[model samples]
Target chain A: MAIKVLHHGLATTVQDLGRPGYFHLGIPVGGAMDRYAMRAANLLVGNDEGAAGLEAVFIGPKLEFTEDALVAVTGADMPTKVDGVAQPGWTAFKVKAGQTLTFDFLKSGARICIAVSGGIDVPEALGSRSTYPIGALGGYKGRPLTAGDELPVGKSNLASEGRNVPEALRRRPGPSAELRVLPGLYWHRVTEESQQNFFADEWKVANEADRMGYRFKGGRKLDFVDREQPFGAGSDPSNIVDSCYPYGSIQVPGGTEPIILHRDAVSGGGYFMVGTVISADMDLIGQLQPHSPTRFVKVTMEDALAARRVRQLNLARLREALA
Target chain B: MSARYTFGGDEHLFVECSEEMSLEAFFTSLSMAKGVRESGIKGVTEICPANASLQMKFDPDVIHPNDILKEVKAIEGAAARAEPVLKTRIVEIPVFYNDPWTHETLMRFRERHQDPTGTDLDYAARINGYGAVDDFVGAHSGSPWFVSMVGFVAGLPFMYQMVERQRQIQVPKYLRPRTDTPKLTVGHGGCFGCIYSVRGAGGYQMFGITPMPIFDPTQTTSYLRDFMVFFRPGDIVKFKPIDRDAYDQAVEDVDKGRFAPPIREVSFDLREFQKDIDGCNAMLEGMLNGH
Candidate 1:
């Protein structure tokens, strides 16, 4: 069974956890920015955590199911309705054929994840079903879900009755709060005052936020301490060099504002990385809408690890429950 | 340190522990570990080219992610004590500041300050003594650089300094960002890193163009290193200049090479990318049909 695209509102595309380990190929890990929500929705529908789903940014599309299927919606609060009736969040629903699923304007957060039973059947590209629009390599023709696109779904006889995501596990509000971070690659190069501003002040998301990175409008430009080339530029300053880039890396060029890289960011960059948002807190960053207030909250390494452990334990339990 | 091996799959495995650590330090540690190579992770197709996260694609049939997570944690722990691996090169570029008008327009008071008696010119005078430009640019060769990150184009490594200098250059705001800034031109007013490979729009006040190829596509590995970059953690890199002849020799081959087949015309590909326009109709068919 497949779902017919009635109208793809805003920017909707197929995204999984993401495509990682291919920075060398010039590909960023373009996946669900809020991976937690993605997993939640997937688990609710009994699909594998890595199954392909819709990453509905801003307002979601009006989707019409062509066949009876189990689906769930999570992440970000969009005004969701089925046949004009208000729908709930983070639980699987059996939608009959021809039933229309409509999502109005997003009330909070930037993106929402929709998972269907048997997962969205998109052709895998380079080992992933995630869409990378820039390279046109993955997902539905490597592009955003459009108004007329039809998406296929694989068959699965697994009962949807048991795969429901519990109410306690639903994504709660507070993702718009301060982001936790680790000191960046070149944190020392920045002025002490800049460090204070980074933590203490609320930064506004600049107009330049995209899948690649988020540029913030804030006080203080992180500058290099020395004029000499720091390192990593192979003998010349041309285009190609052997290099690797990390996630949540904040690159500051000559601009006063800083750009924080996200899921679809490039594999390499030539600017100074003043800091990286902590992995545990990166999901919060994914939910930040434009002009959303963001602050960097510094955490010890131990705290970050503990937070990760908590999340891992949660995921492990879900898997064990499925088993 | 063994003969290389390649793993296959579509799963991304990251150290859940990367939250509070230095991204530079994190990758540096990974590069130093052993048995973290391809064989250890059976389903991992490739290691992503990123500093902050270690991405690996794996096939679910071959290896389950939960089983691999245990090994990934071990690799993360092993990375802490490993010596840093360096993926940085200190290449010095020559700049003549050939335009006298540009110099006069930019720094009008420099000639008067050249006198030995002038206190204002003391810094320049000290640097001018005994092949100073050569000596200054050459100073970078001895120091090692850390491969901080990569992107802009493939293999464009951004390195960082572990130490501070006595005098740091201030980057003045660009008076104008040229919409059509030529590629390969280094910006004026600052010694920003070179755009080694020439492909896209540049913002730097381009001083001059070097006649060498910044990136090479012919090599077996498109990216320079497999595990880590050229520079280790906490290393320094200083630039050293190459003469015109050396630069020419390095770039000549790529300049004359023919485009590989399955190579669609650059114009067509660009049009496909800009599909919203009406004139792009010629390319939209390829986009819709999953070409």
Candidate 2:
């Protein structure tokens, strides 16, 4: 054991890039919500891009180091400290043995990723160190870390510290975020007016947001087109015959709440998804806080592809810079 | 063959085979999903087949999304005339009807149910034209079920009855979803039945509880040794109702890692089953008991 948890922050857990191949088994690709931040933290600490790290939400965990090691904190704008002294985020720093690390209240963003010299030394479950609490698999015993839990750290490669990512390299969305969505298969299920309203409306993130999904409130109720209820699809106009819910898809139950499926969502369900948030914007969704004003900007397939390409290039730049 | 293909953002391709849920549509979707997997497509990462639709997630960087779409359309055209046959397995799941665990949970969520005064079973029986709950249970257990999709949660099988459409057991989900549902509780909603793999929020009408655990991450159960998630998409399931004493014995055996369920391998032909469903089903059942 290398790190002892002095205080369990709000919903802190070990995460990596997650197990992608298991989506067919109904096991979601659950990992760090903000993949970019997680990768940045790992890169700063000289760890592999997808190495396991601690994903702390809202608040940060108070941890005491049992051994001197390199560490980096990324994502969010929370203030970090080492044994009462201040520390800069997104920059690798060393903590001496017996030194305590803590955080001030969150200043901005939703989640923070803390990467140490070596990755979290948890045995891989299903070829991943991601925590999927729904299935009770992976991570530190398949659940969120709590106070008094002593975590094991992998053998450090002994890389030098103080490598900070440039300010421009840090990716965070604005306070009022505009998420581009590509409407799909079930788009025709809604009336044209309601579809326009969905794009035009300004919504606020609900308190129900978590790893499974983020629900948006304060939007006009969506209206569905009239159709003979399909056989075997429940009577609700919004219900489909249980279909796959693609990651980042927006599912509206009863034409009310619009939930954007996130990292730990179910693979398939009966609710109809209006559209999917573009892959480039999923990371942005993770950094959004509850009650944040958000807009769903509709985009075409080509637009979505172009955005994905731009983000891929940015990630490439990050890798090159760190390398 | 004219499946409606829609792009799910930059990654997923959603293919809708039919507007309504049916055994034929499920097979059609499954065939396409299987065809995509076997084709060794460069970018396809995951293929999930649902009731009457399927989704394939591909890396757009490796293969352009449109190029993958063209390949999928070609595969759909190629499998258009081929008869669907699945070499699958059939397993018996022992259940205790009206088990006290589910009964207590269902009672707590009565406000969300369709008929608040009556139990879920009685309400379902009345809506489906069954004279009593016993008759409804008989009809439910009498027919074999196909695991059309194993999802919503890990290892949770969404099943469709092998019986004709007119004989299918249908129920609406609770007016509102309950905050809690007992694990392994047999649930029915729409025309599908699902076994809750883990305890969580649910809206389906609770029918019973199974003695066997279909989902185990630890793989501690003897039946789950081959895989942590027991039920697959193509397996057929038959529910065998047992009394309280038998249910207790099965639980005890499961705790001791001695529960080896009755399972058999068999090939399912859509054409043959369509021609003589009951006859083919009887033969399939006979194979299970060595008749």
lDDT of candidate 1?
Answer: 0.55
* Per-residue lDDT over A51-93 for candidate 2, one digit per residue giving the tens place of the 0 to 100 score: 9999999999999999998999999989999999999998999
Give the DockQ-based CAPRI class for model 1.
incorrect
* Model 2 bad stretches (over 4 Å): none
Per-residue CA lDDT of model 1 for A161-221, tens digit only, reads: 4355666666565645777776644466567776777677778887777777888886565
Measured by TM-score, the strongest candidate is 2
| Model 1 clash tally, residue pairs | 46
Report model 1's interface C-alpha RMSD after superposition on the true interface residues.
10.0
For every model in order, the fraction of real contacts preserved is 0.15, 0.84
The deviation in Å at residue B158 for candidate 1 is 10
True contacts kept of 2: 0.84
After superposing candidate 1, which stretches have Cα over 4 Å from the reference? Answer: A161-163, A223-243, A317-323, B1-291
Best by DockQ: 2
